[model samples]
Target: MLKKVISKTIQLPDNRVITIETGKLATQANGSVLIRMGNTMLLAAVVAKEAPEEGGFSFLPLSVDYQEKFAASGKIPGGFLKREGRLGDHEVLIARLVDRAIRPLFPKRFNSEIQINISLISADETILPDALAALAASSALSVSSIPFNGPISEVRVARVNGTFLINPSPSLLEQADINLIVAASDSSILMVEGAMSEVGEADMIAAIRYAHDAIKLQCQVQKELMEAVGVEKTIGTTHHASAIVCYPIALREAIYADLYAVAKQHIPSKALRKEAFMAVSNRYREQLAKDQNGQEVTTTQQKEWLDELENQAIRALILNENVRLDGRLLDQIRPIESEIDYLPSAHGSALFTRGETQSLTTVTLGSKFDEQIIDRAMEDGYNRFMLHYNFPGFSTGEVKPNRGPSRREIGHGNLAMRALKAVLPPDKENLYTIRVVSDILESNGSSSMATVCAGSLALMDAGILVKAAVSGIAMGMITDPTTGRFAVLSDILGDEDRIGDMDFKVTGTYQGITACQMDMKVAGISYAMLEKALHQAKEGRLHILEKMAETIAAPRLDSKPHAPKIVTIEVEKEMIGAIIGPGGKVIQEIQKETFTNIDIAEQGYKGIVTIFAGNQEMLEKAVSRIKTITARPVMGEIYKGKVKSVLNYGAFVEFMPGKDGFLHVSEVRLERIENLEDVLEVGEELQVKLIGIEPKTGKYRLSRKVLLAPDVVAAGG
Candidate 1:
């Protein structure tokens, strides 16, 4: 039965429209939505494949992809390898963004394989595919049978001339000093990624609120779509809440009372608080063990009893005493120490330590060929500037195998990458490939933000003419005791992050924000709180930037001596074969002799050669060889030559660039010579003069004997 459904589409100022169609598409899935804004469109379908089998779900497998086809972009794939085959970094990142926004809304027991594919049928530069993908996924989940506790919306916010511009175009974004992407549910924010100058916390929060306000209509449109086409609600099976074990309430109260008093008198260190909590837990355990009723308890029962006691102690400490594990004011930021130019070999390097969290970021510059290439189903190939975050087990005081990057690492890296992407120089202006690697030396909370701060300083130190200097700060909020009142902290510690309601990270330059990200542990935050957090974060970010600038004010104008030297050469299509030789023999000989790395484009007209030697001497040698191989002879040029073969009338002399010219005896010299060998031998070097050119053929007529003396020529004859 085809049901006619009403769809709503709201047009925004930035040439973007939010559309929701109800009665059409993917009725069987938990939720589905087809979103179209401008020429950019995506059909996002959300379906949960399966529920958790045995253990509780620890991870959410959410996939988000932005597929770009040649047809959509009005261009075909440009290589001999025609079809798009693999997912690029951008696709992986967009997938991560949607996953982060939606994963938090699912119940822990609903650990199912949830897949959301954002298929791009058309593309418009203004309406960002990423933000559209988020809306589509949210709408699909809201209408689907899959249990999603969301109808979220996202927006791209930019600051141009100190004014917040929502969903700015690509060109407008280029002109704007700050670009921030924010995704929020009705009440709380879910995701943020963008870059700015060193912007204040107050402004950062304002930007978030602005984005929330801007996208409210889109969220409503999604809701209307669900009302129109959403499937019938499936009754979700609820799990029974765990039973709370009985313990001595009086004894637990007394222990917590004493511990609270001690904590109040002396701000206990993290280790001290942990030890004191453990001692109280052990005492309660002993009391249970010595119960005189002869009641034997199982291990599980004992653990439950201990867990209850621990929860009580923690809850009492927070609710009654209003004190944290590590004593600090509710809004107080952690101490920070930032230093740049720490690595001698790297182009730029910085070490940023905020409280216990520390990130060592390094930047590397390379040729255009070094840019990342991404290929996936929906999108063809594209290049990217990348950021990679690494978290070793030692960063958290644990011992684990040293392996490749985890999904968390990828997620963190992508977040930082997105934040900085707005400020990265365009490909045409800066041809150098950029790679920023953030290594977490220690982590407490928001190490990803620490990575951003360090990365910015490293970029500046490396002398990359970035649009602006960027710094990031992590903001945390602790709600008030009675009301939902909260205090936003600048730099949060590990415990604060665990207990806090929000982990908001803002990165940008002094002029404004470049990137911002926010995640919540509780329900969404109010606009006022977000404002306060941003205001406070700005102050903290500026302080960190000041410290960073003291070490390295700007990126060094020159690259490191150890860095690779790249030289690009353009050769004619016909001459490419000659330089490459048959089966690449000629190119191989050049590499072996010069010890350089040479990469030739598949098109055969352009080549990029990288020399990693200690000095320019090796680079010059390699360039000279390439020039010789690809060089062509110019008309009306003189050269020193050697005669290879002689005829009665003329002698064949090697002259010009990679060519041989014929010297006739009549024009060999002023006086005629009896034999060609009399004046020039097979193994002799002689100065040759070009006198005439053959128009039909490219061969040149040279006179070697013309410059010889008459007496010398006659004597030789």
Candidate 2:
């Protein structure tokens, strides 16, 4: 078959062009598309099983994989296998971005195990593939025969020097104060995840709007591409894959009053509230059994009916009577308790509990050797600030094996890391490699936000000197599809998150937002609603911040007494080799003698030397030794030196830590010395003067005769 490729080009605000083409790759799949921007190319292919998997599923079984091949960047894999293993954190994050963008666009009952795979086939050093992955995924779905409500697109908008640029280059993005990845359809935003430099709400909104405009253009291109390909989405008949059982109005009416009363009770205990709801469900089940003359009812069907009833009852209580599960106002936050220095052995630790959710966070400081090495197809560097989140099954009162960090765990840790990174001291001032680990001890809802609060407090407790304290809150929205009425909830409960239309989390300092993540379940949510959510989240965040401040308002003036001390010094690049010496013998001797750790890195013409020591005395010793090594030699200056080795003709003396000078037998003493070893012991220390330096060999010449008395020298000769 002839491959007829159709292409559409989009000109960016910076005048760069991106092209989207179909029919050139993976045509046998349900849908496929290849998108190119600069030298980077991404291929997205989507396929769906004709029918739902056996045993059936009520929700969409969508799986998204975003992979970056090492070959794409003209490099090979690093590990022994020489093949890509499981996705790295960076790759997982991009896949999550694409998943969050297009997950809501599919039909609600489309449970056909749909899989979207995107590959970075070719890469450019400057262009990031995150937003393009989403766009290509959406375009592939648009050209497929499957039913979808989207031709959505995503753009990474950054504000550099007070101007917003759409999908800026990597270098340009580094300079941006406000960086966001926004996913949107032609009309409304579907997902948002990014970090900023404590940017205000208004500025964030402006960035999102700016990105939406660019997203609109990309979405339009997908539409035109679909039309050109003559592929119209097949409006298949809606099939209830699980054979959903809808209860009668009489049954719902029977349970409505009781369910509403239970929901209105405002039970603060999650376990109690859950039990009460279950009691109500059991009553409904018994009534249904009697109504059907005691016929056996499928457990799944009965549970589904009861779930729907509960959703309706809780939503109505909130929307009609302004009553929440916990009796808090729509903008009210849960009670927060925070404490710092909770662990004696840890460098820094904090216990943050907000309502039922809690995070025990700890901070550790190390030298540059502790920094994490990131080696990927497109990006290679060291990450000094790391945050690891762990959610044990016991935290949620469940029994499950611990297999390691899940995708959700990684995503949550990343969001918290971004939030706290904004307040960390600049690289120059903060020299230690920092790691923040949050362990969930209890979870009800918004545990990631709790991690943020605890991590901030722990950092302060560790004397990190953060620019400002950061706090986070989760916001939920419940919308009346028919009436267009919506309620924005602050610090929502787990149930609200499952039943709500949106799960929006905002994190920031007192001045502005630092990081945020939003996922929308419903379509066409107006900007007004989002604005309201942001404002409400801000209030909640401030409340949490006030509570956190009660524990520790600012970073501690000094780190713990047991913590390691770091000192940095800069010297000329020429001095680096002198300090390291041949085969690293000099520096190794210094570290072994001083009992300290040292690292050296070159920047331009200067070398940055960092020393980590146990105490001030050790730090001083290391610093002084490095100074002596890099110190320049002066002519005609007498200095105390140690004899490193002895030879027949002469002996080499170490004038400095790594600087050695040749001392001849004639210069050893005023008298004639026959045996150099006997005259000058190998490990002896003596006074020597810098007489001259041989320019040809760049060797220093020292004289002991110059320091001897004039009469005594002549008599000895």
Which has the greatest lDDT? 2
Model 1: per-residue Cα lDDT over 607-710, one tens digit each: 44433333467778877877776776665555788888888888888874346788888877777678866766786777787777788897888875555667
- In order, what lDDT does every prediction score? 0.69, 0.90
How well does each candidate superpose onto the true structure, as a TM-score? Answer: 0.77, 0.92
Report the Cα lDDT for candidate 2.
Answer: 0.90
**Per-residue lDDT of candidate 2, residues 622-642 (tens digit):** 999999888889998878999
Task: Provide the RMSD of all predictions against the true structure, rounded to 1 decimal.
Answer: 5.9, 3.3
RMSD of 2: 3.3
